[model samples]
Target: MRVSRAETTMNYVLLLGFAAFALAPVITILVTAVSAPLGESGGIHLGNFARAWTIGGFGRTLGNSAVVAVIVVTTATALSILAGYAFGTMHFRGATVLFYLFLLGMMIPAEATIIPLFFDLRTLGLTDTYLAIALPQVAQSIAFGTFWLRAQFRALPVSLIEAAALDGAGPLRALVQILVPASRPAIVTMVVLVFMWTWNEFLIALIMAPGGRLRTAPLGLANFQGQYTAETALLAAGAVIVALPTVILFLLLQRHFIRGMLEGVAK
Candidate 1:
């Protein structure tokens, strides 16, 4: 049935409201980054952003965030894609139990496990390193990423695999050649999700690297707040610098992302 005009109108209204709600803060942040001048400025001073960059130690924090996010996304995607393919397509005993164990990560709060992780990291002397921040994100990301990609992998016709086998192609060959190419949409979806989460992650960064030992961008932003109350412009600039990459990534990959979601939902 066609949607009623009244329903469409209501939907549009709700959509506009949501759009405004979501964008208002982003606009505020960007505007403030340029003009609000978070601290020590009589009014709006664009110089505030540069000051925040230096004083807040944004350079180090940004580098730390970059390294951690890059490592997490790469490891998470590689492991999840491989495991997802196996779990979704190949048959095996104990798979169900293992998948359930993986699901347990979802139920447990990241916060709840931080203390134990801290002790574990302390023992290994990995604390304050990019590895410490990245490993947990990888582990946390894998479960859902695996589950998501498994469905994508499974959606392919088994006949493809059978045909590849008839042609003397091994399982790995078929997966690498045929399955992976066909599943790019889903992989892009996972990439976007993981990157965004890892980029914006604050708590893990906070616990893993305090005192700007290895500050991430979010931590830098927070530290910026403490150092400058009047240089809001600088804060805004830093935030924009931090935010734009993710937004650009989303824009470039959104079509594949939508297709992946639609296909997953249909399956």
Candidate 2:
């Protein structure tokens, strides 16, 4: 069962190769962002970012994206924890059926439902608003969150819950004081994923908030691309601006995220 040093070294080298392959495009983009444009050669064009930010209106769009992500992540995580706890611990009639209904949200693509969703939102006068952008993503995140957190909750020992109950703790108290803390990594992983998904989402934001008043960062980046087809450095700079938040978030929470993912696999 033991691995030799040569095997371990080989594994590390293979992993490095795969990592480099994955990072190659990102490296290219970063290099292109700083590189001189097609003409008028000079030092690395750091000014491209300033120009892109101003021209793309990314300041507003980025703030909109942040607002939507916070709303979705907060609502989805809180609801998912409660749903996960109920499904994982307390069994009831129709629980399986209801859980499968939630899973159906994941099975259905946003593309499939976006048109009708837009119509529905418009009918409710919710279109072109922050709620319009945040709500659907909240629903999407909840489906996965329920699936993820339920497993984590179910993995805890039954004795732990019973012990809390014996100590006069109610269901809410037991969950808040013990289970939530214990499942912090999984919860954090879910938060990071939901934030990234909400941030990167383009289609929903495009269709739901079409007035351009509530454009998210990705939406703004798309518009920037259209206007700057000839400007590679500016395009790359806009892309970096759009992608930077998610990258920073992942870097910040990578330890917890990796632990949560490994635990999910193990479970």
Candidate 3:
């Protein structure tokens, strides 16, 4: 059925309205970040970012977040690819039970387990370190990645796998050389999501790295907000700094991300 011109116009209007609603706060923040702080008179205050960076110690915190994101994304994606392939293609005893166990990670809330997790990490003497922050997120990411990639793998034609096997390709070879390349969009989507979650994670970093030495970007931004409560420009700048990486990553991978999400939904 063809949509009427009035309906098309109405849809465009609704979409534009939603787009503005979503972007208004971001635009306001960007404007505030560059504007002169209250009781000051000047042009664009680019120096607020520098001041925020120094006072917030964002150099260290951003570095820490980057490290954690890398560790979580790399480890979770690799493990999830292998696990998803197994779960999607292979049949074994207890496979259903094991898959549901992985799904349990998704069912459970982080808040429910964070306190116990902290104590467990403390007992192991892993607290106040990068592993303390990265490890939990890696586990969480793997659960989600496995669920996502499994569907992607299952949606592929079985003939591809059969063809690879007929050509004397082993499972590992088939995965690395054939399936992985075919599932690039899904893999990229998982990586982007995992990186964003790991980068923005605050409670885990706050609880695990209590010493503040390994504070992630979001954690540092919270601390910066506390100290600069009256410095609106500086606070806005810090918020932007913390959010910029995820925004950049999303923009760069938006095509693959959107395609993967659509495909996943269709599958």
**The best candidate in terms of lDDT:** 2
lDDT of 3: 0.93
Can you write out model 2's per-residue Cα lDDT over 63-167, one digit (the tens) per residue? Answer: 999999999999999999999999999989999999999999899999999999999999999999999999999999999999999999999999989999999
For residues 1-267, could you state the per-residue lDDT of candidate 1 as single tens digits? Answer: 899999999999999999999999998886777674423545556675676667777777778888998899999999998899889898899998988887777778899998889789878998888888898899989988988888888888999999999999998899899998899999999999999999899988888765558888887787777766555576678787778778999999999999988888899
Instruction: List the global CA lDDT of all models.
Output: 0.84, 0.95, 0.93
Per-residue alpha-carbon lDDT of candidate 3 for residues 1-267, written as tens digits (9 for 90 to 100): 999999999999999999999999999999999999878897999988998999999999999999999899999999999999999988999999999999988999899999999999999999999999999998899899999988899999999999999999999999999999999999999999899888888889999999988988998899889998998899999999999999999999999999988888888
Between which residue pairs do clashes occur in model 3?
Answer: none
Better of 1 and 2 by lDDT: 2
Off by over 4 Å in 1: 2-10, 36-48
- Clashing pairs for model 2 are none
Where's the lowest-lDDT run of ten residues in candidate 3? 258-267
Error of 1 at 183 (Å): 1.0
Question: How does residue 247 of candidate 1 score in lDDT?
Answer: 92
